[model samples]
Target chain A: MSDKLPRLEPAGLDGWIVRLFNDIDEANLSWLAALANRCRTAFGDALVDIVPSYTTLLITFDPLSLSPAEARDRLMVLLDDLEPDTSGVAGGQVHELPTWYDPSVGPDLERVAGQTGLTIEEVIQVHSGKSYRVFALGFAPGFAFMGLTDPGLDCPRLDTPRQRVPVGSVAIAARQTAAYPAATPGGWNLLGRTCARLFDRQREDLSLLKVGDEVRFVPVSREEFERQGGDITPLEERP
Target chain B: MTDTAIGVRVLRAGPLALLQDAGRFGVRHLGVTQGGPADLYSWAWANALAGNRWGAASLEVTVGGLELVAEKDLAFAIAGADLGATLDQRPVPLWERVVWKEGQVLRFASPVSGLRAYLSVRGGFAAEPVMGSVACVMREQLGGFDGLGSKLQTGDQLTVHPAGPSNNTATQQAPSGVRPDFSLEPVLSLLPGAQIAEFSGQSLYDAFNARWKVDERADRMGVRLTGPRLDCRVRSLISEGINLGSVQVPPDGQPIALLNDRQTIGGYPRLGALTPLSASRLAQCKPGQEVRLKATGSGAALQEYRAFRARIEDWV
Candidate 1:
C-alpha cells in the first residue's frame, strides 16, 4: 500500500513535485486532499506553498531558510502520518447556477450533440441531471473544472478551439463540464449559457465557487435569464 | 521624529509598481503568490544604502516612466538601473543617495540601464501588511501600500515615515556600462532531475548544447524559449506540482522556464530546473536574447548560492 502511494520528484530549483501514479479517481483525490490539508496545517510556516492539482501536490520552500533535504524529510513524515478521510469532504456548499440552452447563446450545442450522437434535447437532459464535483480551480481565475459527468454525454474537445469564448459560457469536454468565469480563449465544446456571474472582481469573495464545492446547473428560460439582469452579451463586448 | 522627509507624488505610473518586502511565504495552500522585488539584488542595495534592516519594504518600479514630486525634504537612494532618472532639471546619478527639497520633481524616463529599479527610503515605507507581508501580488489581490494589490496611479498620495539616522553612503556601486551587457549569450546553470533518462540522447545534447532564443510571449509566470525540438520518450505522465525555475518542455518542444509567478502545478515533461541565481540572471535577459543551459551538480550550486547569500548578509 505504501508503495502504491504517490512519489515525489525534484521540481524546479527550490521545490518538489509529488506525483500520484493512480488515475484521478475519488479515492485518490480524497487522499491527496487529506495529505495536502494535513501537511499545510502542520507545517504551515516552513512550507512556502502547497499546490494541489488533479493527482499531485507541489510543495515549494525557501532554500535560504530550509534545505531541500529537510523539506523532503518533513514531507515524508507528514505523508506517513496522513490518514485518508472516509467522510468524503466533511463540508461542501451547493450552488445552483441558472443556465439557458438556447442555440444563439450556446454556440457549440449542435457540435456537442453531433459528436455525442444524441439529440439536442437529450444532450441538455443528460447534462443537467447529475451534480458535478469541483475538482479544482485553475487555467484561469475562477475557472471551475467540475467532473464525473454522465458518461453518455462525454465527448472530446473541439479540433480547432474558438479564439474567444464568451464568459458565462457553460462548456463540456469529455466527462467534465465548466462555466467560463471570464471571457477568454477556450477549446471546450459549449453546451449552454449561464447568466450567473461566476466571478465578480468587485465582490468581497471574487470567486463564485472553490475547489471541493458541488455545482448543479438548472435550466432556465431566456426571459427569466433577462429578468435576472443577465446582459445581452458580456460586459466587455462593448469595449 | 524629524518632520523633514521626501515624498513623491505619482504623475505617470508605468505598467506595474508595488511595495515589496522579502515576500509572504508558507501560504500557497491559501492561494497566495510570493510577491517580492523583481530584482532582489538592487532592492537589497537600496535598503542597505538607507541603513534599513533586511526584509524592509521598498518600491519596485518596472519599465521606467514613473514621475513623482517631492512632498518634503528627504534623502533617498536609487539603485539597480539607470532608468534615466532626473531631479529638478539636473541629471541625477544612478545608484546613489541624494537629498531632494520639497516640491522638487523626480522623473524617470525610459529604461537606460535595466528593466526594473528599486527606490529605498531611510526608514522603510510604513504600510500595513496583509498576511504577514507587504509584498503585492495583483493576481491574489493581496499586499501593497493599500493592501489591495492596486498599482500606483495618478493623484494617489503616498505616505512615508520620517527618515532615520543615515549611515556613511552605501559602498555597493552599480555596475557601469549599459545594462550589464545583456546582449551577450546567457549561460544558465541547471541541476538535472529524476527524469533525466526519460529524454533521448539527441534531446539531451540539443538541450545543453543548443542556443535558445527568448520568446516574446514571456511573463513573470514563465519565459518560453524557442530552440531545437527536444524529444522525450515519456509521452504521458501524471500531472505533478511545479516549482520556480522548472524548465518544462511541452508538446511543441519549446522549453518554458517557470518563474516567481508560475502555476502551482504542471503536466509537461521537465528536463530539470535552473538555479535560483540563474533564474534571476535570466530574468534580466530581454526577449530575443540567446541563452544556453549548463548542467551543474547540486552540491556546487548550493555552495555558490550560500556564498551569494552571505555577501548580501554582510551588507545588512
Candidate 2:
C-alpha cells in the first residue's frame, strides 16, 4: 500500500497536489475520493480545502497550524494505511438531464454535424446514446465535467470562446461535456440546452451532479423544455 | 438580537464595491471558488483598526468613487490604498478609526495611490450569508449584501451591526511602518511550483528577472502579467485544483496569476505561485505597473506569512 501511494507535488506555500494518476478513470477518481476522506479525518481543523479532481487531490492546509514537513508526514502516514472503497463509485447515482437539442438553443448543432460528416439527427442520437461519468466539477458552480463522449461526437473547442454562453447551455469541449450552470464566457461546442437547475443555493447539495455520478442527456421537445422551466431567449455569438 | 442596526445609504456606488469576509471555506469541492477581499492585508487592518474580530464583513471599494450617508452615528476605519476619502467634504484620514455623524457624507475619490480600499465599521456590516459566507463572488452569483452577490449600487441601503458598549473607546490607528507605499512597483515573492523545472532555462531566468507589467486583463479572478513569452515543454496537463497566486503560463507565454475568485482548477503549465502577501500586494497594483518576481522557498515564505498573521492577531 505504501509503495502504491501517489506522488506528492508541492503546489505552493500552503498546498500540496497528491497525484494519484495521469488519466481520468473511475478507479483513479474513486481512489482520489477515498484519499480525500482520509485527509479530512487526519487533518481535522488544520485542513482548508481538499479538492478532488480527475487525477489529483489538491490539499490545502492552514499554514499557521500545520507546517510543511508536518503536512507531508501526515499525508505519507495516511496513504500508507489507505484502502480505497470503489463500491460507492461503481454504483453511483444516475441523473437524467432533459435536453432540447435544436439549432435555436444549440447554435453549433449544424457546425458540429458538418464537421463530423454526420447528419444533425445522427449527431444528436450519438450524443444522447451513451451515458457519461461525471469526472469533475469546476469552471463554475455546479458545472459538472462529464466525459468519454462517443468518438463520432468528438469535437474541438471553438476558435474563439463566446462572450456569454447562456445559462443551461449544454456544451462539449473535446471528449468532455457540461451544462453552463450560469451565463459565462465559454469555448465549448454548444450541443443543446437543459432546463434542470444545475445549481441552487437553497438545496442541501448545492450542485446537482457530484463526482462519480452518471449523466444521460434525454432529448425532449421545445415545448417540453419550456414546460420544464427552460429559458428560450435567443442567444447570439459575440466576440 | 432584533435591535435596530445602523443603516448606511449608498449615495454613489462607484466602480465596484462589495462586502467581504475572510472568505467561504470548506466548499471548494462544489466547484465554488473562494470570494474574499482581493487585498487581505488591507481588509484585516481595517477590521482590526475598527476593533472588529476576524471574519467580520468589510466593504472592498475598488477604484473608489463610493459615496455614503449614514442615518445614524457610526464608527469605522479605512485602510489600504490612499483612495482620497473625505467626510462631509473634509479629508478623512487613512489607517485610522473615524466617526461619521448622522447624515454626514463619506466619499471615496479615485485612487490617489492604491487600487482598492477597505472600509470596516466597528461592528462590521450585517448580511445574510450564502454558503456560510458574505464574501461577494459576482461570477458565482453568491454571497453579498443581498445574499445574491450583487455589487453596491446607487441608492442601495447597507446595514451595519451596532458595536457593543465595550467597543466605544478611543480612536485607533495602524502604525505608519505597516502601511504599504503603493507608489513603488512591487517585487513579488514566488515559490517555485511543481512544474518549474519543465520550463526552459532561459524562460525560467526571464520569469524571475524580467520586469512584468500588470496587464489590463485583471479582476478578482486573476491578473495577467505581460512579459517575455515563457515557453514550456508541456502545453497542458490534467486539470488540477489551482491555488491562489498560481502563476500559470499559457501557450501565449504570458502568465496569469490566479486570485481569490479564480476557477477551482486549471490545466496550464505553472511556473510558480506568489506568496499570499505577495498576491495581496499584486492585487493593489494598477494596470501597466512594472513588477518583478523573486523565487523563494516554502519555509521562508511560511515564516514571513506567520509573522504577518501574528502581528494582526495581536491587534484587538
Candidate 3:
C-alpha cells in the first residue's frame, strides 16, 4: 500500500522532491523508475533534471518557463493517475561484469574473509553468487550504487576512506557493491577488480550502468582480467 | 591546431586554474555534476566585456599565481577578484577590456581582494565539449582545455576561438553596482528547504544570527561553514539530488554549501539552499572569512535572479 502513494515537498527556489517511499528496497526503485519516466515525459523541456535515488526523485524545473505552482499542479495530476509497473519486466537493463576476486588487487579480501569467518574461495563464491540491483548512481560520475549483497558478505565501510581507490576496483559497503569508475578516495571494502570501464567520455554512452539496472559479478581468471584491460598492479603498490 | 596559433600560452600555471562554461545540464542522472564557474556573476561579466555571449568558456583562476604570454594581438577582460593582476609589469585594470600585444606577459599574483578571478578573451577560450559542456570538472575527468578535465598546466597553449564581428559589448565596462566588493563580509540569502522544520528553534536562530567562518577544507566542490553546531532531529535521509547551493548539514551540525563541482546527490540532511547570487558571493570568501545567512522567500529570490539575468541580456 505504501508503494502506491507519493508525496511532493518543495526544495529551495526551483526544486521539488517527490518522496515516493521512506525506505530503500527493490520496490521503491521500481516505483521511482516508473515515476522518473512519467516526470520526464510530462515535464519535457521545463524539467531541467530529474535525479532518481533509492526512494525519492528530485525534480528541478526551469523557473522562467514554468512557475512552481503550475509545476506542482501538473505533478499532482500525474501522481493522481500514476500506475507503477507491477510486472517484473520493468526492471530495465541487465549487465554482467567479469570480476577478479584476487588478493593482488583486492587488498581487503583477507580482511573481509577474516571478518565473515569464510575462506577466500567461500567469500568469492558468496560475492559473485547473486544478482544485485542498482539503487542509484552518485558520489562520482558513472559510479553505480548496486545493493542487497548476501548477509554473509555484509561489511562496514572503512574507519577512514582510502586516499585513492584504484580504478576498476570492485568494492562493497554494507550491502551495496560498486566498481570505481575512476580512481578516487573511497571507503568501501575491496572484494575484487573489474576490467569494465564504468564511465568513459570517449564512449557513445558515457555511463555503463544506470539506475534500476541489474548487475551480476562473474568471477574471471587473472589472465582474462589483464587481457580485458583490467589493472593488475597491486592496490598498495599503486600510487 | 593552426587556429589556436593566436592565443594565450600558460607560462606558469598557478595552484588551480581551470576552464569553465555555463555548466553541464540534463546529465545528473548519470551522477555527473554541473561544472561551471563558481562565481557566475564575475564569469558572466568577464565574458560580456570580451564581447562573447553567455555560456562562453572562460578561465577561472583561484588564489592567483597564473602567468600567461599572449601569442598574438588579443582583446581581453578580467573580472571578479582583483588578484593584483599585472600586464608587462603594469597594473591591469579589472572590470574593463584591455589589449594584449603579441608576446606581452600577463600575470596574476596573490589575491588582493577576492579568492578567484575570471579571465576572458574576445572570442572566448575553446575546448572540446564533453557531455555537451566544456566546463572542466577534475573530479569527473571531463571537459577542460584537453577535454580530459585537466587544470591549466605550464606550457599549455590555450586555444582561443575566433571572435565574431566586433560588437558594442566589447570594450564595455561593468556597471559599478554589479561589481561586487569582495573585501566586505557578505550576508547571503537562503531559501529554507523541506527539513527546516526538523531543526530546533535555537539552531535555526543561530543559523541566521551567528557569524559563520569559512573552513580551510573549501574548494570548487563545496564550502563547509564552521559555526554553531546545528542540532536537528533527523540525522540523514535517502540521498537526493543536490543543487548548486544546497546547504547540507551533517551529524556534526556544521553546514556545507555544495557548489559547482559537488556530487550530484547527497544523503546528509539539508537545512535549505542559498540563492544563486548568494552562493556566488559565498564562493569568493576566503577561508576564515565571516559570513551570515538571511532567510528569504522564493518570490523575492526569483525576482532577484531574473533582474540579474535581464541586466546581462539587455546591457545599457
Estimated TM-score per prediction?
A: 0.83, 0.96, 0.96
- Candidate 1: residue A209 lDDT (0-100): 76
| TM-score of chain B taken alone, candidate 2 | 0.97
Q: Give me the candidate number with maximum TM-score.
A: 2
Model 1 clash pairs are none
Better of 1 and 3 by TM-score: 3
Q: Which regions of candidate 3 deviate over 4 angstroms?
A: A1-5, A85-91, A237-239, B1-5, B169-171
Write candidate 1's Cα lDDT for A151-203 as tens digits. 88888887877777887899888788999876667888887788888876456
State residue A77's C-alpha deviation in candidate 3, in Å. 2.4
Q: Write the per-residue lDDT of candidate 2 for residues A1-239, one digit (tens) a residue.
A: 13343888888888988887877776676687788888989999999998878888889999999987789889988788677758767767799999999988899999999999999899889899989988888999888999889877889999988989999999887888999989998999998999999998999888999888899999999999999999988787553
How much does candidate 3 score in TM-score?
0.96
Total backbone clashes of candidate 2, pairs 3 or more residues apart or in separate chains: 0
lDDT of 2: 0.89
State how far residue A180 of model 1 sits from its true place (Å). Answer: 3.1
Interface RMSD of each: 3.8, 2.6, 2.5
Q: Write the per-residue lDDT of candidate 1 for residues B12-33, one digit (tens) a residue.
A: 7777677888877654543445
For candidate 3, write residues B171-200 as lDDT tens digits.
388877978998888999998887888899
